[model samples]
Target: MASLELKIEAKAKQLGLGPIGIIKPQAMEGYIHRLFERMLRVPNGEKLHRGFLELFDVRQAYPWAKSIVVTYADNSIYYLPNVARKHFGKFFLTDNRYNINAPARKMIASLTAFMEGLGIRTSWNEHPGVTGLRWAAQEAGLGIIRRNNFFFSRRAGSYVSLTGWVTDTDMELRSTHKEEPCPEDCSLCIEACPTGSLSAPFTMNMATCISCANSYTDSTAIDDHKLNVLTGSWLYGCDNCQDACPFNQITGYSTEIDFPGLMELDHYLYPEIIADLDYEDINDFIRPKFFYIKSESLWRWRLNAINVLINTGSSDCTRILKKLLKDPFEIVRRRAQNALELLGS
Candidate 1:
């Protein structure tokens, strides 16, 4: 069994997935339950469940589940936007094209097949799954949850995506290595947060997060201050916190796997191009990769773009804002009107 586990670990590393470890499902129950309870207490905490602990009743999903194989793929934040802009001439947020979720899913599928070939039954989960990835990864000793509320591995910083597989096979469990990856004196990420989302050390107020505000499907749900915070050139997700982390400066891009979709940047929409977009353009070009924004939430993108223009304070944006004043979506029209007011045009 030890030899087989070694083989599996080597195979995973060969497949460009690693910092792998194993843990018993029972070990995670208490931590997950506590985390779930806390999540329910926060505003918009209901939405956090899918990524945190909603579907992840390990005993229920994997009745025979004995161990979870937690694995992470190197997703250095440097390569993501840099490669997209170099190839596609535009910056990309953490969408399908640049985010590690897509590659993590691919790794899970491949790992499942590999385990099945060795006569082991395996089930895997990604974002909205029966496994809470961050907790599981931390339990498996792959990383530590830092003060910024992101998983930070010694080798990968916070620039990796997590995935896991559950199986009936009783593998040797990795010892839990509880770590405080953050330096005691450094609070750069907390200070850099524009919306005061990082309320304290290792705490996050998700409702106030600029990234959450940018991704909100309903533009009306966000107030003016949140809107202003998001207006600072962010169209989808905010990287201010990550950018401030000193540990993230270490290079992990060398080990990053060149996944297929990383180069597919046609879906990335820029601020200068938003005023010219119609429903057809969005449906045909942007909808496929940026699916998280949703078809009904198309106005959010327009609002983000308008906010970007407003933040730039470019007089040239007046023409674009005027065009968007007649936009079919009420949210776009209203945001555009407000943007014009800010522009004093």
Candidate 2:
């Protein structure tokens, strides 16, 4: 008779999740304490970090959750369009959480169903951070936590999508901590960081992070000149730290694996096109896809595109900037004015 652990591993592979890792769930005291400390120093820390405290303890949310099974998808497998590759981070490019029919989403569904058949109660959490996944994955022996604050498997690097569920059952344990978490005192990711947001090893300033800045931030609210200049043409998200990692420097993207709606998004994401999107276009065509910026926040997306145009600096971009000056939103109009000024137009 096969053990439940072996059965779970086989099912995970069958669903294309690659492998499965099971570990005892407990309160991440160290991580939680750090978050509490951060909440005291940074602006909006209490509002942002408070909610995730409960997530650090699996029993807090699910009293019956004795263990968690973790699985990951190597996103290096998918090929993204050039525009997407340029404008968006790889994580967002391969993310299928919003799309029910996507292969990654389907893999989770199938894996969950297969696990439940083994007669174990299950509960899955959505977000990566609040769940203290970096700690969980490291404790579970699935991967090593790199200095860049990303989990890297021996094979997949940091370009992996993580999914996990808490359950009442505990499986056999083994540690696969491969390479040195910090090889040769690598500070490449910290140096490669544009905004100097990586303040120290494994510590990032959320206030200055380009990824954090791009989310839910109005264009009018972006006050840092250096941050704007540093972000360059990253209109949606940034990935400089991950890109600089030697471990992430791999090739041979899978021709067989595909992201269902990723290719089609190229139409709406070109900086020139997104800069001119109207309310209807933004709501119907754009909001459903990236969705970091909320409805009625057209200024944010337009500003992102305008900034991209300004940084790229082309004759066509100047022309588009001039046209953007006539946009309905005052913030968009002022941003276009600033972009044109920066271009000496």
Which candidate's lDDT is highest? Answer: 2
Candidate 1 runs further than 4 Å off? 33-51, 81-105, 175-180, 218-220, 252-268
Report the alpha-carbon TM-score of model 1 versus the true structure.
0.84
- Give lDDT for model 2: 0.75
The residue pairs found clashing in candidate 2 are none
39-140 per-residue lDDT for model 2 (tens digits): 765567687667668768888778887787877877778877777778888887777666676687888888788888889888775555326776677777
Number of the predicted model whose TM-score against the real structure is largest: 2
Report every candidate's CA lDDT. Answer: 0.67, 0.75
Residue ranges of candidate 2 with Cα displaced over 4 Å:
33-48, 128-130, 218-221, 251-256
272-312 in candidate 1: lDDT tens per residue? 67556887777666655555577777777777677776776
Cα lDDT for residue 250, candidate 1: 77
Query: What's each prediction's TM-score?
Result: 0.84, 0.90
TM-score between model 2 and native:
0.90
